[model samples]
Target: MGTPLLVAEDISISFGGIRALKGVDLTVEEGQIVCLAGENGCGKSTLVKIVSGVYTPSTGTISIGGDSFNALKPRQAIAEGVQVIYQDLSLFDHLSVAENIAINRLIHDGSVLSNRAEVQRIAAEQLERIGIDLDLDAPVSELSVANKQIVAICRALSMDARILFMDEPTTALTTNEVKRLLAIVLDLKKRGMAVVFISHKLDEVFEIADKITIFRDGSKVGDFTASELDEVSLSFHMTGREIVYNRYHRTRTEDQPLLEVRELSRADNYEDISFTVRPGDILGLTGLLGAGRTEIALSLFGLNRPDSGTILIDGKTAAITNPWDALDYGIALLPEDRKTQGLFGQQSVKTNITSTMLDRLLTPMRMISGRKEDALATELVHSMNVNNKDISVLVDNLSGGNQQKVVLGKWIGTEPRILILDSPTVGIDIGSKSEIYAKIHDLAADGIGIIFISDEPEEIVANCNRVLVMHEGSMITSLEEEDLRADGIKERLAEIISDPDSFAGTNSGARVQGEQA
Candidate 1:
């Protein structure tokens, strides 16, 4: 390979007493895919954060094209042609594709201040280069996650970035979309652009990578050519310890659905959404981003009002006018966006956990005692396996997985009859994911109806008794028992999206039943 576009040596990062990255070494050859594989807390994100200038390494050297860049700041890193596409893709959805792509140029207001047409032309060219032919004026929010990711790639390419870092690029992409994105990555590699691909999916890594590095507990396990690794070995390296990747083949309870939504319509977002979540049963919802998975959860949790529908709780029609109303009806929700919607970042871990149960903690004086609060909080923190030195610690300081645990812990403490978790394992480690799944299983076993909404299909198929597929604001179809495979669900969802009326009774058709978008 030609001179490496970027190389980092002995990168070490520490957070207080915890060493997030220890002696981690990596290299990105020009026009090549370099994959960093590890469990969530194994320093993959931390390493990428260092490369992207979001975090400074405690000890390390980062060189761009053989030039040392130890002190490079984020803007400086981008200026030097380094781009990090985060898990969310970092695109502001409200803006048009053209505006999102041309952001940097707009920020600089360069000497060509009067050349607005030229800027648009350049953005259009970048889009074309990335094989995206969408309307430049189209709203990014309207774009599918796969298309949005391509738009992000176009924006980075617009910067003329020398090296691009993709973090879990396909976490939300369908198989076809994933293939298309990979083709684009390969095309970029052919065009001599370096790529650092970080993913939880090993098959994608093996398919795309030239070199692979595994990190465990902030330390590098080993680095080798793609030819030197396989799924078994790569996974073995990721977790560092033996793990049994077992899923409950069938965890359904014969109990009928305790919660039912009928003819739920939410205007333009989702339409005629209907599904049943059974008590002592785990009902999983899966779809692409903007596929109405989260939308359905939010609507059921009273975060959004359905234009018209009947939400039946325990076979009884109920009005969930607000979240408090949902809570009053024994419904609890763990929102998708944790920092904003899930947790109060500034509060203590204890306080965050107990906020959902004030009435239980109150005295006859209607006041909560700090001691009772601490006791309850301590029990929950331990139960959820939230990692924190002290219950008094601010929740903001904990890792993403711990924060997520706290979010679930908050709702779990409420003892709701119905629990809805939206992407509950988004940022959690494999260990934590197992823990959370166990908790979900335990809850389901206890007769608490659970709605598990996730972008990961395997997860839905594995943990849930029934898989509900939503698209364009409605629960289009559902898969049970033998038909809940990821590919099967996507096909079914697409068919329904094309014509909900047409695919009403078809059992996951392979035939194209509706108009393509």
Candidate 2:
């Protein structure tokens, strides 16, 4: 490795008697990509914030180019050529792309008057340096998620940053967008800039990381080169447990489907979709970002009404015009974005958990029954294995895993016959993921028909008894039983995602039936 550009030694920090970080050491060399990986609440963010001058470690020393400091302020870190791009990207939605790129430089240089032409010129130069092209005059709000991320990167580079940290950059990006972002990161590395990538996705870590450091429960577990570890070992290091894939097998009780969708069509989102989920079966829907998987889920949950289709529940036609109708029809949905779509962040855990079942918790006087609500919330929280013991605490105070559990608890409390989980374990940790998978299996065994949607092949293979693959707003293929167990599922999925046109010829039938063993 070349000379070390950023070194953080023996970092320790605590808050309100709780240790957030403990004796963590991190180093980034010139022209190298280091990945910092850990489960949620594992101190990865704290350590990075310490290095980037957002947090002052209780005990540590950070050195940049042989210069040491006990702590740094925001301006000081920027002056030292350090930049951080958070998950939110932190761009002004109302401003133009050019203004967003050049605002940092203008603020740093104490510019008195705004110059539109100079801002566009600065943005053009930065974009040219990064080998990307975009309309500078376009408002940031109109840009896609991937383009917003690009603007964030250009904004950092405009400040002449030598060390860059990207936190969970690919969480919301499409497959192609992720690849483009990684290519840009590699180009920066080749230019002698140090890059620190923080993400929960192992495939990405292996693809772009030169070295990796793992954190667990506020301590550094170990560090290794990319070749030294695989996904399983890396998961173990992150969560201190082995993640075994135990596929759930369903025992068919009756031929009658619990929920059936026939000829479901939503203009640009999906077309000619048909599927059936039996009681105690976990049906997985997977596809690329814009493949209409989510739109189908939204239709099922009544968030998006289908243009033309028939939904049958218990062999009877159903009309679902809104979420309330869906709920009345014994259906529940756990959305993909928990923070925005699922939880009532400022409310108490008990309130969030019991939000869906408030009608049942009403008293004879028409007022809510507080005692009954508490008991029901308590039982659901325990059933879902929520980490927070006190149900009275606000949901926002919990970790990512617990917040997700709260969402599940809320929906499961509704006692729906059909439950649709959209990317349930997106930001959760390994241990929590295993727990959630087990919970899903248990739910199915209790005769709840589950519709599971995800983009990860391993998750589908592990927990689902049947799989449906979608591409370009249509169902490409369906795998069941042994077909789902085939080792080539990932390869097939890759082909479908990377080259949709090549797979279209094989889609002679709308849904290919899989053999049952």
Output the number of the TM-score-best candidate: 2
lDDT of 1 by residue, 423-514 (tens): 88875656667778888888888888888888565576668877776654555566665554434554554444434556444433222321
Report the C-alpha lDDT of model 2 over 119-142, residue by residue, as the tens digit.
999999999999999999999999
Which residue pairs of candidate 2 clash?
Answer: none
lDDT of 2 at 225: 96
Which run of 10 residues does model 1 get worst, by summed lDDT? 508-517
